[model samples]
Target: MGAKDGRKGDPEGFGPIEDQFQAIFDDFFRRPVAGSGRDRRIPMLVSLEEAASGASKVIKATFEAHCTDCKGSGVLLGGPPVFACSVCGGKRHVLQERTLTVKVPAGIDDGQVLRLAGQGDEAPLGGGQRGDLMIEVIVAPHPRLRRAGVDLFVEVRIDAETARRGGRVNVPVLDGERRIVVPAGTVSGAEMRLAGFGAVRLGAEAVPIPAEVTAAPYRSRSVGDHRGDQIVTFVVGESSTDGQDDTSEGRRAARNQGLWRTGVLAVALVAAVIGAFVLGR
Candidate 1:
């Protein structure tokens, strides 16, 4: 009887039902499954030496996880639903803090991010898959050194006599101090290269040491067979004096010239006074 009414018998009449099924399938696939949390990004600060040599560091991070009290449903299931979950307050998740030990790769630059799989937030009532955690690295500035890509630059102050005579001088290195030869007639801002002293290149086979071993210096293989160079720039004079002529003779000459200028100024002031008195008379 329904076929006779042209409702069930027509193929076009089934279009609305097929469309409804298609819509249902699409919605089911598009919705995120429970327990799949969002990814998070956090910052990690490291020293220049630490960045050059890979090390494991412990860091604290906060993220969200499904509430264990309500099982992520946001309500109590044992009784008739009357109010939200007391633990999560209907949010389905709670903030959780955890300490994680992360490996910082050698030669890692500032603003670079390292991803840890499944370390992000836990899914809220979704599936068991957690999101990834991204750690953005921040390299601290060194007191006497500046970094450019894989190269490191340092300014070493040398006296005028040493700059002219050319001799060995102590310069700072990543581990400690080292002596480098300076050629005769070397001027200020002259740069000398120390090969294999700079940072390790990224993607090198660098192995990280344990956190406990960080206090004691350990070299990582991440430097591979070759490393970047450290460029030493020679600055003449004492750094504390702001690039002034620091030689003893130079200081004595400067004082004598200052005294001569003071005497001349005094003499000019006395002559002006005598001329004024004469004009008044």
Candidate 2:
């Protein structure tokens, strides 16, 4: 024989080996590999009350997804010209809009991030894996309340009479109004604690306190799990107006006082007119 026409055990002359190599190469390219796509980060703004109590928010985001027309291959299949896909322009992925509902956990702090897996860009070239979406939580500043860690701080303005007589004063809480006791002889800048009424601790199970349980003592002890206390700073007289106008009752009281003063002035004017007329007679 001039030369061996084929290998000793192969009669088909490398056809099967070529087919096997081609199959392996196709499989390798089709499978998802690392570094296929990029993760995306977005900022989510939420209110302090929503962060404290946890809330569900709808968000609209743009992400890269596999091109449906070309099946993410970047090129048109079964084409004699072998041209790039018109839809994706050979990028293999297209930008698409997605609406997602995000669940913000209770006690989530500002600048914290929430990761959602497989919500970012899809892998290129029809790869299966997808990147993650990072949601950075941005907590808006509260008007009457401030937060430090899990503790909540608020300035409460009380009348001089309530401070002297030791009465119940309404304090602002996350859920609603909470009445806190003002001790006799309480002075301005006095700090009081409402236990188990602050922001929920991270990773701690907590439920919203009932609205009926309004009265919380100044030095109340902690009663539940995964909760921080609300710190109340008292301000007497007209020194501050941080939390005074937050309550409707305060507004109503001010209105009533104004009306009473106006009525007294009218009565005094009428009495003066009558006295002048009687003196003339």
Candidate 3:
């Protein structure tokens, strides 16, 4: 899929999920398959089915949904009549904010959830503890870099000068300062990769940007050895300095990506390549 330019507004990340786990009545066995790999402790995703006559599995899915408005007291913030809940006495909650930072363990895939205890609504009658709050994590898309598990994809633009002569370039990556080598005649939209620059893995390798080949429009796939190349798109420009300075943040980032220089190099490269072919033949 084509990536939307990152130079635009920074896409707002989906906020955290801070409520109860919505139950799926049927049985859910979050356990490993009978025989798959050496990892026995690894959990499996078993679908739940409603049982008929008899069954050995059962689940008690209980949770307290927080009060939507006055934040758990079921009262308007203005004054008296629309006032205090007689039970908790306007204190709002019978439980404290669940303070367990809740470890977001690695290997946990996207949309995975982490639960924190006592983070929901308290009993209206008082005395009992609160409900649990679940946080769901989702991976956000990167404008320039594409993520594949623990790997990252970064796209770099090379000008006719950098492509034909080859040089060092500063590229945008998950962890910045990724110095990349622009090969001679590198062409436009060519990608230079930094190995082990991907997301964090569990233990053995916390995070690694894998070395594999890349593809996609202004995108990177595995950085490797194959028919993969950095795709280049060309744009013709009217050469003149009569335009105002690109003061906006987005324009500046585009310029840093060498888009301005790329336009010039594209025209120049075509002329040079044609001249060489004709002269050589």
Candidate 4:
């Protein structure tokens, strides 16, 4: 018998018989009303150089109402048998744009997050917490500058002549160009210190390095001095010299010629002495 009939024994002949059961549950209890969900969002980012934003400037951020066409939903709405989801208004989450002034604290490391309080959208259901918006201050890498911890490192290539001769070398500093004295006999790879030549320190309130010369001594020793190291790889001349045998008569002749010239020089000296004696008499 059909579900409406009272007969109980395998009426449809599909499976084992069972006692009467309660399988029907109402679907209307789960449908949500309009404005039921808390706020949900996706954000956009804009990055501009610090100098680009002039003084006395303010940036405003705002959110738009959900689109009525697609109802803030991006998807194409409406089909015959199956209908589109109405909650996203056919557009997914409604937009809730917000704005906050991003403070770039000095000496903040790259990728560090700055939290904006109460700036994010509200939670969808139950009036839960608003989402947190994090802003990161990125100091773009300088093409010429290399940074360490509080220490900033810079490399300069000095010619061997200048190093050996010892003279003034120009080094770049944070604010301006500086002249540093490179000692005489300074070898390549020698690191000389120009004090106070580093990046901005975050908290400690003091000028970093005083104007003082830090000599990185070389491993080369000349009796007594502090020494580090400078690896100097020499390029040897591979072209060989032509062979000359000492026993060859040509060399003997050359030697004999030199002896003969010395003999002539001696004779001239003797004559000069004799002439001096005659003049004295």
Q: What is the C-alpha lDDT of each candidate?
A: 0.70, 0.73, 0.37, 0.41
Residue-wise C-alpha lDDT for candidate 2, range 178-270, written one tens digit per residue: 765667677989988776778888778766653534454433344357777788999887433433333435445567789999999999999
Error of 4 at 64 (Å): 9.4
lDDT of 1 at 196: 65
TM-scores for all predictions: 0.65, 0.66, 0.38, 0.42
Tens-place lDDT digits, model 3, residues 136-203: 54444545655544445555544444445444445554434444444455554444434434444433
lDDT score, residue 36, model 2? 61
Candidate numbers sorted by TM-score from highest down: 2, 1, 4, 3
Worst 10 residues of 1 by lDDT: 208-217
Q: In model 3, which regions exceed 4 Å deviation?
A: 1-85, 88-100, 106-110, 117-131, 139-143, 202-281
How well does candidate 2 score on lDDT at residue 11?
A: 61
Clashes of each: 10, 0, 15, 14
Model 3: worst 10 consecutive residues (lDDT sum): 18-27
Of candidates 4 and 3, the better by TM-score: 4
Model 3, C-alpha of 82: deviation from truth (Å): 19
Model 4's alpha-carbon lDDT is: 0.41
